[model samples]
Target: MRGEVEQLVGILFRTLAEEGYTEAQTALLDTYQSKADTDREELAEELFVEVVTNLSYHLETETEVEVLVTAIEQLLSWFSSLVEAAPVAILAVETDGQIEFWNDGAERVFGWSKSEVHQRPYQDVFAASSDEMEPHLAQLQDGKQLTGLETQHQHKDGSIRDVRIWAAPFRTRHERFEGATFVISDVTEQKQREQRLSVLNRVLRHNIRTDVNIIHGHLNQLAETVDDTTEHLRVMEDRLSNIIQLSDAARHIEQLRDEGEDGLTTIELESVIQERVTRLRKESANATIRTTLAESTAVVAHELLPYALDNILDNALEHNDAETPLVEIAVSTGETAASGQTTVSVADNGPGLPDHEQAVLTSEEETQLNHSSGLGLWLTRWIVRNSSGTLSVNKSTWGGTRIEIRLPTQTS
Candidate 1:
C-alpha cells in the first residue's frame, strides 16, 4: 500500500508536467519529485493539494505507467549540473574509504582530475596519514554529520592547503550506513591574512602598554627630583611624542590592510622625492638636505609613497648627533630598460643604524631580541612591500646608514 502511494505521487507529477502547468507549478513539481521518495503519504498529499490549488490544475494520479519511470529526469539532470559546477569541492567516499565521486570543484581545488583520484583512498587528499582520517570516518559510520570542520589537506604539488569541511553520512534504502559526502572550502589565503593581522595587533598592543608604563614611571621620578629636571622633562616629552606617533602608525597599518593595493598608482620617483625633500628642508631649517633624483623614473607604487619617504627622511635627521645633520637623497634607474629596477637611496651622515634595529627590517621576522626602534621603519617596509618594492639597510659611503629601496618600473 505504501508503494502504491509513492507510485501515485510520481504519476501525478508526470501528468502535471505534460499539461502545460504554470512555471510555479513546474517548479513545485520538481521539488516534489526530488523529495517524494522519503516524504510521508500525508505530507505528500498536502503539498500536492497546495500546488494544484495554486495552479488550478486538476489531479490525474493514474497517468500512463511509462511516464512515472521518467518523471524526475529533469530534476536529476539539474541536481547533477549543480553538484558538478559548485564552487566548493564536493566528493563522496565509500564505507571502506575509497573515493567514489569527485566533482569539478574538487579537481580545481585539489589540482587532481576526477580520473586521477577516482577509486583512490580518501586519505590521499589529506596531508596526514590514514590515522588522521580514522576518527572522522568513524563518526560518519555512526551516522553523524560534520559541519565546518577546519583542517589542512594536501595539494597535488605537496603544498599544504587549509580547508573547512562539511561531511554527512549517506545511508542505503535499508537504513545501512554506506558512506559519506564531503564539501570543502579552500581558505589558505584567508587564514594567512587573519594570522598576519592577529600578530600585528598583538605586537602593537604590547608595545603601547609597555611604553605607557615607562612614561608613567618617568612622571613619578620627575616629581621627586626637582634638581636638573630640564633634561628629565625633555626625555618625558620625547616618550609622549613617540606614543602619539605609534598610534598614528597603527592607524596607517590598519588602512594598508583594509585597502590593500587599491591605492597603487603610477608615480614619478623624481617628483615625489623633490616634494618630500623640499618639505623636509623647511621643517629642519638647520639641516642640509641634498637630492640627486633620476628623471622619468616612473614606478607603480602606492599614493602613500611620500609617507614612506618621509619616515626615512625623518629617521635620518632625528637619529643624527652631528651639529648640522646632512642627508643625501639619490635616485637611479636600472641598467636595462626591459627588466630594469628603479632604486632610491637615502643616506644620512648620522651614526650608522644599530645592528639590532637593522635586523628588524632585514630579518624574515620580528622577535623580542630583534624589534624595531620605532614603528616608523616597520610602516615604511609595509608600504614599500605592498607596492612590490624591496627595502634594505647598508652603510653609506659617508660612513653612516644608507637605506635603499628598489622598485619595479611600470611596464609599457
Candidate 2:
C-alpha cells in the first residue's frame, strides 16, 4: 500500500507539471532535489501525506490514499466532457478517411449514432462535395489548414445541409501525419436571412422608386404636352420595360450571391453577344452597329449577363450625337495571358463618356464628387465586379468612347 501510494503521488506530481501548475510542481520537486540523499520512497510518502493534509482543509474529498487515486481518475474522465458540450460538430479522422473520434456534437449535427459510424469513411457526411473536397485534401496533404470552406453535407436522412467547415491536418506528438479535424457549423438559416434582407434593401432603394417615377412622369408629360407626344410616348414605353428588366437582373444578382460560387456557369461569350446585338439592331434601325466575335470565345458568368450587355449597348446609342451614330463591338482575350479572361470591347462614334463617368469606373478610391448621373455604367460595372471580372474605359479608334470589360474564367 505504501508503494502504491508513492506511485500515485508520482503521477500527481507529473499531472501538476503537465497541467502548468508550475508552483505546485516546483514545490514537489524541491522536496527531493533539495536533498538528493533522501530516499525516493520517503520523499513520495512525505509529499503524499502533505497533499492529503492540505486538501483536507479545502476540498470535501476523503484524505485516504485510495480516495486520492479515485479522484485523479475522475479528473481525467471529466476532461472528455468538453468535446461533448461543444456546439459545433467536432470529428477526427485518419489519413485513409477512417473516423477515429466523433463527439456528441458530431452525432447531433450529422444525426449518426456512434455504434453505426465508428470506423466509417468521413466522406459519408458529404453530399457531392467534390468541388471543395479536392482543394481541401490538397491543402491538408501539403500540411496546410483551411477555414470557412462552405460546402454541402449529407445528413443521415439524405437531406442536404449547408455548412461551413474548418479543417486542419491532425498529427501525433511525433509529427506523424494522421487524418484531420473537421469542425462544421450549419449556416443555412443565416444565409437565407442575408438574401432576404439584400432583396428588400434593393426593392426599397432602387426598383420601387424608379418604376413609380417613370409612370408618374409619363402621365404628366402626356397631360401637359398637346403637340406630337408619339415619339415621347414611344421612349417612355422602352424606359418602362427597361425598369422591369433591370429589376429582374438585380434580383438574379441577389440569388447568385446566396448560392455563392456553385451557382455560376460557363457562358459562351459570342452567343450572348450576338443575341444582344441582333436585338439592338432591331430596336434602333437608324443606328449603325457592327460586331466582331470569334468562334469560341467564352466567359464564366451568371444568367443575368445579357441584361448587363444590353445596358452598355443602349448607353452607347442613347449618348451618341454624331451624324452617323456607329457602335463597334469586339470580343477577344486580354493581355493577362496567365489569367484566362475574355475581353468584350464596345466602342461608339459619340461625344464619349464625361470625365466624371470615366473616373467612377477606373478610380481606385472614389469620392462623392466622382458620382455618375445614371445607373447605366454603374450597372455594367456591378455586373463585371460580381462575376470576378474588371471594367476599363478608353478612347476608341472610331473617334468616340470605348468600354472594355474583361471577364475571368473562374467563379468566386
Candidate 3:
C-alpha cells in the first residue's frame, strides 16, 4: 500500500510537470530524490499539502487574469452573435480554401445551412469554376483585402444572385496570415437601378446633343431668311417642346427612383385604361380611341403604368399618317388565375413603327445610328422593366404596330 501511494504520487507529479507546473515539478523531484527512504505516508501528505497551497496561492493571485479571460470570452460570444444576426452574409475561410464559419445571414442569403457548408471548400459556395476562383484565391493568399467586389453568386435554388463582397485576410497572434473573412451584401436591386440610370443618362445626353445642334442650325437659318418664317417657327417650336418633354421624362425617371419599391401597387387595369382613354379622347378629338377592357382586371405594377400607357397611346396616334387614326386599347389575362399574368396592348391602324424607333425597346443596345427619334418609347420601356414586367412590340392585325405591356397579376 505504501509503494502504491508512492507510485500514485509520482504519477500525479509527472502529470503536473507535463502540464507545465514547473515549480511544483521541481519541488516534487527534489523531495522525491532526497527522501526516497522517508515514510511514504508523510511524503505523500507533505507533497499534497504543498501542491494544494501552491494551487490556492496561484488561484488567489490570478483572480483578475481569470476574470479578464472570462470577459474576453463573453465579448467574443457577443461579437459572434452580432455577426450571426447581421443582415448580410458573413463567411470565414481558411487559407486552404476551407470554409470554417457560415453565419445565419450566410444561410439566409446563400440558402445553404451552416451544417451543409461548414468545413466545405469556399469554392462550393460560389458558382464560379475552379479556374475563375484561382485569381481570387491567389489574391487572398497574397494577404490582400478585397472591397466592393461586385459579382454574381449562385443560390442553392440554382438562380443567380448579385452581390457585393468585402473581404479581409486575418492572421494569428504571431501575425501569420491564416484565412479570410468575407462580408457580402445583396446588391441585385441596386445594380439593376444603376444600370437603368446609366442607360437613360447616356441616351438622354446623346439625344439632347443632337437636338441642340439641330436647334442651332435652325436659329442660323432663321437669321438668314425672314420670308415664310411660319414653317421654320413651327419646326423650332416643336423641337423646343420635344426638349421640354425629354426633360420631363428625366423627371419621371427620378420619380421612379425616388418611389423605388413603394411605387409598385395593386391597380385595377380596366379603370386605369379607361381613365387614360377618356383623357386622350379629349386631347385628340380627331383620333378615334377604342377600348376592349375586361372588367376588374387587376395587376401588380408600377404606379406609373398610366404614364406608360399614355406614351404608347400617344405614339400610336402621333406616328399615324392616317387621316383618321384609329387606336385600340385592350386588356387581356391568362386563362387561369394561377397563370399569373395580365397583358395591356395598344394597337394602331397606321404605318407600323420604324425599326429605329422600335430599337429602343427591342435591341439590347442603342448606337448613334440605331437610336430612337425621342425618349417616350425608352421611358415606357424603363417603367415596364422596373415594374418587373415585359414589353413587346409586334405587328398588329390592322397592318400597324401593337405594343403590349405584360405585368404580374395581383394574384401572383
Q: Pick the candidate with the highest lDDT.
A: 1
Q: What residue pairs are clashing in model 3? A: none
The sequence of per-residue lDDT tens digits that candidate 3 reaches over residues 195-283 is 78868776786788687778878776885677656786778767777776787787787778777667999999888888888888998
- lDDT values of the candidates? 0.80, 0.74, 0.79
Q: Write the per-residue lDDT of candidate 1 for residues 315-372, one digit (tens) a residue.
A: 8998898888999999988778886688899999899999887886677677888888
**RMSD (Cα, Å) of model 2:** 14.8
Model 1: residues with Cα > 4 Å off, grouped in runs: 1-233
Q: How many steric overlaps are in each model, in order?
A: 0, 0, 0
TM-score of each: 0.50, 0.51, 0.50
Which runs in model 2 stand beyond 4 Å of their true positions?
1-147, 150-165, 172-196, 199-246, 334-339, 363-367, 409-412
- Summed over model 3, clashes come to 0
Q: Which model is ahead, 1 or 3, in terms of lDDT?
A: 1
Write model 2 residue lDDT over 1-412, tens digit each, in one string: 3565766676776665555656655666766576567677777767777656544543445423444566478555654686789988888878877788888987888788887788887765565563546667667867888789877788888877789989899766687788888888988778778868896868664856586677868666775775555777667666766666556656665665666566557888888888888888998889999999877777887555676788788889988998878999998876555768888889999998889989877775457887876555565666677677788888888778999888875433
